[model samples]
Target: MSYTVALFRSILFWIAFFVMSSISSIGGVIALPISHRGTIFFVRIWAQAHRIFCRFLLGQTIVVEGEMPDIPVLYVFKHESAFETVEQPMLFKHPAVFAKEELFSIPVWGQAARFYGLIPVDRDGGGKAMRAMLGAAKAALAAGRPLVLFAEGTRVPHGEAPQLRPGFAGMYRLLGIPVIPVAVNSGLAFPPRRWVKWPGTITYRIGETIPAGLPREEAEARVRVAINALNPPEALLESN
Candidate 1:
C-alpha cells in the first residue's frame, strides 16, 4: 500500500515539477530579470502549492514547536528532503534563500528568484557565491525580508547526515539578524529516493535565533551550537 501511495505521489510530483518548471522558465525568459516582488510572489505561490500537494498528495503533516519570529530572520533549515522548497516559505512566510545562479538560468522561476532578492552563488566561482550570500542577505534584511539558507547547499537522501557548507557560519559576523535553526527529520519518513514510503509525521522543529552582532567566533560558535543542539550527541558534520 505504501509503495502504491509513494508511486502515486511521485507521479503527481513529477507532473507538478514539470508544470512549475515550465511556468518559471517561460516567465524567466520573457522578462530576463524580474523585480523582488516578482520573486516573492513566485516563491509564495510555489510554497503554498507545495503545502497543498504534500497534504493532499503525500499525506504529510508539519508541526511548529517554537514561535516563528515576525522580523526578517536568517532561517537555517536542515537539508533532508527536496520538499524544503515547500516547507520554507509556507511555514515561515518569509523565504529569501541563497540559491545557485544555475537556477537563474532556468526560466520564469529563475527570473522570479532574481527579482525576489535571492542570493545566487556559483560553486565553481570559488568564494564568489559566499560573498553574494553575505551581500544579498544584508540587502534583504534592510528591505524587511527574512533570509533562508540551507547550510548544506544540496538536498541529501534520508539517513545521510547533514553536511554543512563553511560560509553559513560566517553570517554570524556579517548579518546582524536573528538566526532560526531548524531541524527536520523528513528524510526518515518521506524518503524521496524510495518508491514506497511509510505514512508518518514529518518533524519540522525551529530553534530560537542566535544572538546578533556577537564577535565572529562567538557568533559562529553560537550558530554551530544551535544547529548541533538540533541533534544532541551528533557532532558538527565533517567536511566531505
Candidate 2:
C-alpha cells in the first residue's frame, strides 16, 4: 500500500509540475517586458502552487521553524532535495537566488529566472566569474533582496554529508550581510533524484543569525555547525 501510494503521488507530482510549469511559463513571457518584480510575482505563485500540491497529493506539510528576520540577509541553506529549490522563493519575499549558470540556459524557465534576479554561478570561470558573482550579489543586497544560496552548491541525499562549498565563505565575506543558516531535512520527505515523496512534515529549521563582518573562518564554522544541526551525529561528524 505504501509503495502504491508513493507511485500514485509520484505520477501526480509530475502532472502537477507540468500544469504549473505551463502556467508559469506563459506568465513569465507576459511579465518579462514589464519588470523584474512582475516576474517574481509569477514565480512566487508557482511556488505556492507547489506547496499546495505537496500537501494535497504527497501529504507533505512544510513547517518553517524560527523567526525569519524582516531585513535583507544572506540565507545559506542545506540542499537536500528539490523541495527547497522550489519552495524558497515563496518562503522569503523576493529573494535573489544564486543558481548554476547552466540552469539559466533552459528555455522558458531560464527567461523567468533571469527576470527574477537569480545570480548565475560560473564555478569554473576562474576569478572573472568570482568577481561577477560578487558584483551581482552586491547589487542584490543594495536592492534590499535577501540572498539565498545552497551552501553545499548542490543537493545531497538524506544522511550523506558534504562540506559547505568554498564559494559560500567567499560570498559571506563579500556580501557583508547577516548570515542565516537554514537546516532542512526535506530529503527525508522528498529525496533527491527520485520520485518517491514520503508523507511527512518538511521542516525548514532556521538557525541563529550570525552577525555580518565576521572573519571568513568564523562565519563558515558557525554556518557549518548550524546548518548540520538537524543531521545525525555521525553525519555531522562526517561533514566536519
Candidate 3:
C-alpha cells in the first residue's frame, strides 16, 4: 500500500481503537464491582475487536510460529511494539501481564487494568517493589492465570535485542515456574511511537520453555537468546 493509503487506514484504525478502548475500559470498571470475570470478559472483547480492526481495516495478519501452552507459566515476550501489549488477551487465557507502574496510574484505564489483572512494575523500586510484584504474581498464579512479562522492560526498535532486565531473573528464581520465551516481529508492521502502520504479517515465535531454578546467569542467558531468535543476526551480534 502507498504511504498515503496506509496512513489513512492507520488513522481510521486508531479512531476505532480509541472508541473500543474507551467502551471496554468503562465497561470493565463498571463490571469490576460485581464480578472480576466480567472485567476480563470486556478485556477479551476489546482485544478481539482490535484484532478484527487490524485484519479488516489495516490489512495486517498475525501468525504464530509455535504452539501456545495451555498451562500457567511465565511468558517472557520480546518487546517490540504496542501490538503485543494489546494482543495478550487474545493470545493467552486470562493472562496477568506485567506492565510499567506508570500505566497503572492512568485514570479510568488504570482502574480497568488492575481489575483485569495486570501487575505493575516499578523499575527503580528495588526490593520493596520486587516483593510487591511477586505477591501479585503469586496471587495470579494461585488463581490459575498465566503470567506475561516483557523481559526487555520496554519496547525496542525492530531488529534490536537487548539484555533481559533484572526483574525477570528475580521472578524466575522466586516463582519457580517454567518460562516460555516469545519472539515477535510486530515492530515491522506496527512501529512504536508512530501514527502510521503498514500492511504485513506479524510473526510470534514461541521458543522452548526454560525451566525454573537454574542459576540466575544461566536462566537469563537462555531467555536472552530465545527471545531474540526472531531478531536479525546482526542485531543479536550488536547486542552482545
- For residue 208, what is the lDDT in candidate 3? 95
Arrange candidates by lDDT, descending. Answer: 3, 2, 1
The candidate maximizing lDDT is 3
What overall lDDT, based on C-alpha atoms, would model 3 receive against the true structure?
Answer: 0.91
Instruction: Rate residue 108 of model 1 by lDDT.
Output: 56
Taken over the whole model, the C-alpha lDDT of each candidate is 0.66, 0.85, 0.91
Error of 3 at 71 (Å): 1.8
Across 68-147, the per-residue lDDT of candidate 2 in tens digits comes to 66457899888999889888777878888899999999889998888788999999999999999898898888888888
Judged by whole-model lDDT over C-alpha atoms, candidate 1 comes out at: 0.66
Alpha-carbon shift of residue 35 in model 3 (angstroms): 1.5
**Could you estimate the TM-score for every candidate?**
0.79, 0.95, 0.97
RMSD of 3: 1.0
**Candidate 1 regions with alpha-carbon error over 4 angstroms:** 24-39, 126-131, 158-163, 192-198, 213-225, 228-240
Question: What is residue 148's positional error in candidate 3, in angstroms?
Answer: 0.5
